[model samples]
Target: MDDSQKRETQQRLQSCLPQIHEIHSICQTPSITFGVVHNGEVIFKHSIGHRDAQQTLPANDETIYMIGSCSKMFTSAAVGILVDEGKLSWTDPIRKYVPEFDPVDDPRIGQEADIIDCLRHSTGLSPPSMLCLGPGGTILTDEEDLIPLLNVMPAVDGEGKERFNREWIYNNYVVGLVALIVQRVSGQRFADFVRGRILDPLGMRRTAVRRSDLGGDGNVAAPCVKKSNGRFHGLSDESWPCEEYTPLLAATGMRSCLNDMLTWCIAVLDAERSENDSSYQSQVPNNPLKQMTRVRRGYWTRPADDPEFSKDAAYGMGWFRADIPSSMLSAFSGNGFSREKEYRLHLQHILGKGSEAAPFQVVGHTGGMRGSIFSVFTFPETQSAIVTMTNGRDFGDASDFTAQLLIQALFDMKPTLDLASWARTEAQLAGSNYQKHIERPWRENRHLGDLERDPLLYVGDYRSFNGRFTLSIGGVADGWSTNLSVKFNHRNASECPLVFYRKDVYSFYQVDEDKWKIQQIGAREYKQMLLKFQVDEGGNSVEGLWWQWDADTKPAWFENVRNRNSTQKGAPFLVKSYSG
Candidate 1:
C-alpha cells in the first residue's frame, strides 16, 4: 500500500485490461469508472471507458448505477430510523411486526432470525427457487417479491450456516421485508422514512427510490447489454426496462449519483462527529421515528462470508464493518459488481472504526455495476464523509484499489499501481487482436450477409433445465439481427442475457472440416455462459441456454420454436419483494 507499490498495482490493473477487454468481447459491454475520496474530500474522479460502443456518451460522477445488494445498507439504515423512534428493537422477533412471516425450514428455529440477523444475514436461510426451468437455482434478487416465494421454495438447504446462521439465502430480500415491517409499524413508507430520517437530513438530494419520485432517473448510468455470445454490446441506451426502484424497494432499485452518494457518506461521517459532542438522541430536528446507535460487542456473531474478515467490525443495524485500521476509527460498506448469469451484483463492503481526525466510528460503503465503481466513506465521529462513484463492471475491484490509492496519496505514501505501464500492456493486447483480425467491432461480426447464411442457427424457446430461466427473442434489429435477451421472469433487468457456464451454451462458429464447429472462442473469461442453436424450415435463428445463478438451476432446457419473437408464462401468484 505504498507509493511505488500503488503505481505498480495501477500499472498491472491497466495492463491487465486488454486481456480483460477480450473477456468483454464475449461477455457484453465494458464501461470503467473510477473516483477517489480522502480526508473527507473529493480528490480525484475519472471515467475510463464509454457507456456503450455507440461512442455517443461517457459516464460522469452524477450518473446513477443500481447498487444491487448494496441497497441492504439503505434497508439497514431504515431499521435504524425505526430504532430512533423506539417503535422497533434489534432483538425483536420479526413476527412482532410481520406476523405472517414463518420460517419455511426447521420449525424449532422459528423467529430466531431477528432484525440483526436479517441485516447481518444470519437467518439460516438459503437462496430460494420453486419456479421451474434451469440447473441449480437462482438467488432471488430483492426486487423479486419473496415472502410467498420463501414459503413455496422447497426448504432443502435448511438453516444453520457456518456460524449460527441460516443457509445461503439472499439476505437482502429478507432484510427489505423486515424494513417493510418497520414501515408498517412506524406508519411511514420506507422511502419517506429513509429520506426524512437519513437522506434528507444528511443532504443526499439525489438518493431516492422512485424514478417518478427521483424526477426522471436523472442522468443515470446505463446497464450493460451482453450479447447471446457473451460480449459487451458496448454502452447502449438500453435500460433495465423495469422500474429501477419498484418491485419491493428492499435490497436493490434505489439510484443516486456519485456526488450525492459522496455527500451521504460525509453526512454519516459528520453525524458520528456531531453525535459525540452532544447528546446522541437529542439532535433530531423532529422525530417522526426514533433513531438509535450502539456498538454491538462482536463484529459478526452468526456467519462469516470469508474467514479473514473475522476481525471485521461486523454489522451495526444497517452499517457494515470496514477493513480500515480500527486505530483509524472508521468503517466501510458496499457491494462488488458481478455480471454473472443469475445475479445483478456489486460486491459491496463497509469499513469503519473512529479515526483520529474526528475520532469516532467511521463507516464507508462501496457499490459498482456494469463496469463502474464507487466508494462512500464517512467518519461518524466527525460527521464528515467522502464519496467516489464510477461506471463499469470491469472496474468492480477498482473501488478498493482506488480507496487504497487515495489513502496512500493523502498520507503521501507510494502508489500501488502504475497507469503508464498498465496502459502499455493493454494496448499491446488490443493491438495483437487487431493484427489478428479478431476485433470485429460491431459491423463485421453481427452483420452476416443474410440471417440464413449460416446453417446452424440458435433459434428456439430456450429455458433453463434448473427451473430458473425463461428467455425469448424480442425482435429483429439492424437487419440480419434479431434482438435477444432473457425473459421478464428472469429477474433483475429481465432483459440482460443470463450468462450460464456449462449449462450456458450460446456460441459462434467458423467453417471447419467442411462443417461449422463451435468457435471455441470468446467464451466468458471471468463469468459462466453457454450456447446452442436450432433450425426451423430452411431459416435458422438462435436460442441461448443459460442458467439463473440466483436459483439452484443447473439442469436447464430449451423448447418450442420461433424466429426469436416468442413469449412464455409460469405459475401465477402474488408475493412481496425487498423494497422496504
Candidate 2:
C-alpha cells in the first residue's frame, strides 16, 4: 500500500477509533477483521478485538462471524451453478418440486406462488419469520426451515395482493421452500449443496454450516449489545444458534472467518474490465456469479411502488437494490435471522448508513446477534471492499452512526455531526407533540360478508403453514388474538398457524384469493389485521392467513427496546401486531 493510502487509512481509523474504543472500554467486543481490496490487490488485512471477552482469546485472520442472510448470495449463486449444470429451471413453480404445496387461508393462492417468487420474495405469504418468529415464539425448524408452510396463509395489503410479493417482507418459509427445491433437484441438502457447489470449489476453508465446525477458534467476534445506559457491552458465549439453529439453515445459520469473508467480497466486486461472457467464468475468467450482482428484477418493487416512506427501489433475488446517483452498481443491506424474533432486539441501520448512492455508491449488508454487528462493503468500481465485524454493541452511538461515520472518514468526506441532529430535533419536537402522534386514527375492520354469507360452509377450523391460529367460535380471545389454530389430524395437511392483516379488504382483490390473508387482530393494536380464517368447501379443508407481531418498526431490524437510558434506544416504541 502507498504511504499516502496508509495515512488515509490511519486518519479514517483514528476518526472512528474513539467511538469504537469507547465501546470497547465497556466490554471488549469479539474479534474484528478488516480486509481492503483495491485494483485487484488486497491493500489491507487485519484482525482486532477478542473472540471471547472473559477468556481473552484473541481473534485472528481465520476467525469467523455468523454471516447470516448474506448467505442469500451464496444460496443464489449455488442455484445458479445448479441451473448452469441444467439441474433446475428458474421459472419452475415450487409445487413441481414440493407437491405438498398448498397455502391454507387461500389454498388456491399458496400453491400458485412460484419458485422465482420464493427467491425474489414475491410469494403472497408474509415471510414465516414475520409471522412465526417476528413475534415472541419458537421457530419450527431444527435447521431454520419453515415446515409445512404451504399450510400458512400470507398477508394481504390494502389492495388484496399478497403483501410479501408486494413489499419483499420477511418470509423465511418461502426461503426454506427454496432450500427444499435445491435439495430435491440437486440431490443434496441446502447446506451441503452450497458448500459443495460454491464454497468447497472456491476453497472457502473457514466457512461452515455448523458452529461446532469452528472449533475453539477465538478469532470470531461476539455480538455487540447496547445497554440501557447507552453504553455498548460485549459478552462472550461460545455456544449460540449458529451451532444449533438449523431449520432455517438457508436463512441465518452459517459462520465464516474474515479470510473467507474477504475472499467472498473480492468475488462480489469482480468488476474486471474484461469479464468472461460465457457462463462458468469470472471477469478474469473467474466464477461468473460475480457478474450476477446487478438488479435481476427490473424497475418494480414489491407490495406497491417504493414504500411512501422508504425509498426501496427494487429487490434483485435476495439482494435489495437501491437506485443511487452516479454509481452503476446498486447497493443493498445484508439480511439476518433470529429463532425467537423477539428474544433480543437489534435495529439493523448500520448496513445502509454509508453514502446514500452518490459520488461513491454505498452497497453493503449488515448482520447482528446478541450485540455483534458484521458489515460487508463493496466499491465495485475500485474493486474495493471492507468487511468489519464487532462483538461490542454499545458505544453511546447507534451502529449506523458509528459505521457511517467511519465510512465517511474513509472517503475523506465531512460527515456533519448535525446531520442526525436534525432528525433528533424533529423527534424531540414530535415528542413534545406526542399527543398528535398518538391521535392518528387506527383502521377499522370491514365486514367479511362473503365469508359470513358462506359462513357455515367455511366456518370450521382452517390451518396454514406455521401452525394454525384457529377461527373457532366456541371461545376465542377478544383482544388482538385471532383464534388461529393448527391440528395434525386435519384432513388437509396444510393446516398451521395463520394470521391475517385484513380479511375484509383482502376479500375484494383479484390477484390471488388467499394470498392477501390478514392477521386476526383488529386495526387498533396493529396497523391492520394480517391474517384470516377460511374453510374449503370441497373437503372440509380449512385455511387462514396468519401473522405474528412484526414488532419491528420501519428501519430497525430488531430494536433492543428495553435499553431506556439511551435516548435513541429508550424512546418509547410499541410492538405492532402483524397485520401485513
Candidate 3:
C-alpha cells in the first residue's frame, strides 16, 4: 500500500473514536484503556473513565492492570525459548525437568505425562476443581513450596483417564507445574526468566510478572471488582504479588499497561509473518511463534460459555484461533496492517486451511483476576491487533463489548443486535447469580446471634490426617470478629480467612478462583462455603466442623479428634492437635 492509502485509512479509523468511547460507557466499566496496532506502529491509543471510583484518577494508555491467565502466553513463550536452545522439547517428559513433579498418584499417567500435556491441558488428570479446593486446594504462592504442594494433590482416578483425554479442560495447577519445569530447567525464577528473556527484549519496561516489579513511577490502575448493583469497588491493592503463588505466577501473575501490551502484540504479529527485519524473530525463534499461534487441540463442540464462537474453535500453545467477521479483517488490511506474504503462508501451513482466504482468523488470549479483565487479539491476516483492559470485572463482558465495538467502528460494520440492552441484561443476570451463595435462604431462618459456646472455646489448631492442612481458630481485629485461617503443610503463611456469620457458621468468600477464573459472574460468586462448628456435650469444647458448600442441608463433616495420636471415625477427620 502507498503512503496516501495508509493516510486515508488512518483518517477513517480516527473518525470512529466517538462510537468506541460510547461503547466503553455503555458497558458501565469503571475504566477501560485500549490500543490498536497496525503494520509495525501503534496507530491509535486511548483510555476511558476513572481508575478509581472517586474519579480522582483518570486512566491512561499506560495504566498497569493484572493480565491474569494472559501470562500463560509469556510462560509458553519462555518454554519456546528453551526449546529453541535445545534445552527441552515439547515432547520431553516433564518429570525429566521437574523430577519431583507428579500430577497424580497413578504411575501410568505420570509416566506418560510430557511437556505438551501440560500446555494442551490433557494430562488425563482430574478436573481443576478437585485439586484446588479445601485441604487439597491450597494455592502455592512460594516457589520452594511447589514440590510439597504437588505431593499432596489426590491422584487422578485411573479409571477416568480415557474420558479426560477426550475433552479439553483448563487447569491452572498444570500450568503452575509448567512454570516449575521452566524454573528447574532454566535455573532462574519464573518471573525473572520471562523478564530477562521476553519482556526486556521487547522493551516492555512497564510489563512485569510480579506486583513489586510494576515499580513506583508508573501509572498503575487500581484494581476494581464490580458489585451486583452495577457499581465498581476498587480493590485495596494495586497488583497481585507473584510471591503469593510462585508456580501459579506462570498461570496468572503478570501486570502490564496498554503501551507495552500493544508492543508485544505487534511483535507477535510481525514474527508470525516471519518479517526478515523483525526484532521479535531476532529474540524469539519462529517455531515457538508458530507453535504458540497454531491450533494444538480442537473442541468437539462450541464452548458453551461463548456460543458466539464457532465449534471449530480450538486452543493453540498459549493462544487460540478466534473467528471474527471477514469484513473486519479486510478493513484492517486497508488501514496498513496488511498481512505480508510470509505470514499468510505460515498461517496456511499451520492451520492446514488457507487462513488468508478465510474472512476471519485471529489468534489471542483473554484473562481475568479479581479486579481486572484483559484481552488481546492479533490478526495475522490483517497484521493488526486490539488490546482491551478494564478494571471492572462485570463478568469480563466489558472487554468483550469493547472489542466488538472497536471492530464495528473501525470496519464500518452495522450493529446486528441491541448490544446495550443485551449487556445490561447479561450483567444483571451475572450479578444476581454471584450474590446467590452469600444470600442463602437458610441465613434468614437461623438466629443471627452469638454461638452457644464462647468464641474463645473454638480457638485452637485443627489438623487433617496426612498433616497437609491445619486450620487455626483465632480472634480477628479485637474480640468482635471471629476468624479461621488455614495453613498448608505448615508452610506459607495462612490464607482463606473464614469470618463469623451466624451461630457456629463461618462464611468464607474465595477471592482467587485460580483455575475456574473465567466462569460467568454468578458461577464465581457461588464459590463460597459455610463452616459450621460442632460442640461436645459440655458445649465448651469444639468437636467437629461441617463444610456446607451448596444450599443442600447435607454437608461433609470433619469430626474433631479427642486424642492426638488416636484414629478418628468419619471421613478425613481433623485432630485438635497440630501434627508438626
Best by TM-score: 3
Writing each residue's lDDT as its tens digit, candidate 3 over 1-580 gives 4788667657756665565566566556688888777665677788888888666889998788878778888877888778768887888887787676654445644666777677777655433332233332234233554554454343434353342355565666677788888877889888888878888877888997766677887477766655545556665442254544655677877889999998888767766566434444333332233333332233222242224322345566667664654222221111111123322221211221222334466676778666677888777766778888887764425775566555554444444223454445445554543335434533453455765445666666554424434455555555665455544224333244655667776655443433122222222223235567777777767876665322221233455545354554223422233221
Error of 1 at 462 (Å): 13
Worst 10 residues of 3 by lDDT: 329-338
Candidate 1 C-alpha lDDT tens digits along 88-190: 7877877777666665544433556577766666665544422311211122233334554444333344233233263433444566667677668868767
User: Tens digit of lDDT per residue, candidate 2, span 229-336?
Assistant: 443345333334333443355655567777787777666655223342334334433444533543233324533122332344455555544432212121222111
Candidates in order, TM-scores: namely: 0.58, 0.60, 0.75
Give the TM-score (vs. native) of candidate 2. 0.60
Q: Rate the local accuracy (lDDT) of all candidates.
A: 0.43, 0.46, 0.58
Which scores better on TM-score, 2 or 3? 3
lDDT accuracy of residue 298 in candidate 1:
35
Better of 2 and 3 by lDDT: 3
Root-mean-square deviation of each candidate, in angstroms? 11.4, 13.3, 8.8
